[model samples]
Target: MSTETPTPFAARPGFVADEATGVAAHYGNPLSEQRDLAAGRALVEAGHRAVITVTGPDRLSWLDSLTSQSLKGLAPGQSSETLLLDPSGRVEHAAAVLDDGVTTWLIVEATEAEAFAQWLDRMRFLLRVEVAERPDVAVVGAFAGLQGVEALAPNGLPLVWEDGWGEVAEGGVAYADEPSHPARDWTYRETLVSRDALAELASSPVPAAGLLALEALRIAAWRPRLALEVDERSIPHELDWLRSAVHLDKGCYRGQETVAKVHNLGHPPRRLVMLHLDGSDNVLPAHGDTVSIAGTVAEAGDEGAGAPAREVGQVTSAAVHYELGPIALAVVKRSTPVDAGLVVDAQDTAVAAAQETIVPPSAGAAAGVPRMPRLGAVRR
Candidate 1:
């Protein structure tokens, strides 16, 4: 009684469909597949992603005027991402972008395809650009070291997009200044492939991984996904999205003023963190689960019988990593103590969690403007 369209890759052995994502959750052995994927020994079918194309001499400049990333000077075969925010500076949409000279391909979440394409079409007034979804096109993901991925490109131009999350992008700033950032080793890449190519791979010797493997690796790297991490109140600063999807020096856009003001004079109200969950119970916290201060629970234990733990944040994404065990990314109040022990409410049990800061409490106010003395203030 499911309405999900069957993926072309479903014919392979041990295929189990993810009811939520409409893609393969795993091919029987997820942990082994995760190791193989990290080792460049497998490929993952990202069929849950949608492809859109914009073509014309004005495509680059048109996009540059609207998104958070500067796209006017995008060179051929360059990979970048951009954010579309509401007028009030809340994140609305995001896409992985690649230009192949003749066309600019946008790879986005399948759930975002219709609305995103409709918005672009409505915005195209007398512009030379044309917007259309490429249903015939599909996305395949792999680590950077995977061999022969370049040959899968159409029109002799490589359509692979290598995300720039490992280092701070040009005209971008980092709030996570940890010396050993996990994103330092992130080398994920997504390539555009035709349906015929997908079928060919399904019948060939290329080993396949699934969404489970990819999600585990992505969570381990602390990579944020638009569909998972973004919410109605999300701002680029909260998730450290400015480090990749935002260009601080870009020209006027809908949310530019708020972005600048928060970065230079104010701090974000919330910060993103990675939670190291205790795996003893083997319970993984689901998205939107309430996160509470463990100290509050302990203090309540010292009191009479029962007391409620103080809510601190909410878990955004979670996964059981191949080597790291249970891990998750959560967004907590900026004032939450960095050293505070936390717990996630999972299946009626309090699972202990340790915080690894991704965005610090001190994030924002980048201009460092000196404070001016108030009138009639006494000098010490």
Candidate 2:
């Protein structure tokens, strides 16, 4: 890791390198200019989804019964990741859930709201849970290095703060109208505040980073996000999602059968691994690039890389960090050689690469691979 510290921004958490500052200095025109705080924010809002809140007394028990993570024990101000699954154990939706004691808030991909809400509604038979979509809420994120900000949540998930960040608690749990920022999977609402105040609170003048930067940071930390790191055909074990989202000891849910069986007795069909792309040029392999190892290909498309352009795995997310160079998050078959040199066919050229395990083998990954754990798992 680079020992240099980043530059300081008033509201931003971490330091921005001089080079990074120069690259992001231009914000007015996105197309013709490099992205700055304003531009990055605009792009992030446009490209990514917002936060969705679910209110009512039955929220916790309701969501707990439907998702993989154990939410029954969630305190008033705690949060955690939850994975909704298909009957066969495939991932349907994943969200950062927040429990504000009375209500539960879910921060998820925008496109997933309708489907997830419908599913929740359909499942709400005699349960006390009331499922409604709260688009009125805004979602914001700050990098890990903010100084002097205290986090609101008890668990203090990484998504809540950067390395040096601290947070201030604005309101107590009982004050529904109090302004609150729940860390990681926790959610809170403030009806007393106007939209303007909410907007200002959510919109800081910090250097806004794109999904690309976020993706790079996420992949580096081994954190998996939906759509990019997960697929419908994939099981929770394959992505090591169980570590944070699935509670193995937790009671039953839709996919619990497969989750238990596969975990206790069988190996997952595939494994999530990180690839360090080699070669000089900055060309990043697209999401579906093929990976090759020892001239044999195992999986194809974005699911896995396949043959005669023989592939060992497929790139799910790839990025060139200002510091980490070119890196990727990929899912490869367990059969692929860990020590074997790998290559990615980015467009027409073959880029050399190395593979590391971010999620350990016991978490459904293959043995002897270097795995990076999800972000927040790191103890401060």
* lDDT for each residue of candidate 2 in 1-380, tens digit (9 for 90 to 100): 01142212213333233232221222333222112321233222212344555666777777778888778777765557788999899999987776666567676766677788888888878776777775544344434232322233322332231110012121101101113211231211111112233334334543344344544545665556786777768887777666567777677888888887777666777778788887487678988788777445444454445545556678899876545578888888867765777888889777878887644444432223466788779656
Each prediction's whole-model lDDT (CA): 0.87, 0.57
- The count of residue-pair clashes in candidate 2 stands at 30
Clashing residue pairs found in predicted model 1: none
lDDT of 1: 0.87
Candidate 1's residue-wise lDDT over 237-309, tens digit each? 9999998889999799879999999999999999999999998998999999999988676544475446667
Error of 1 at 249 (Å): 1.0
Q: In terms of TM-score, which candidate is strongest?
A: 1
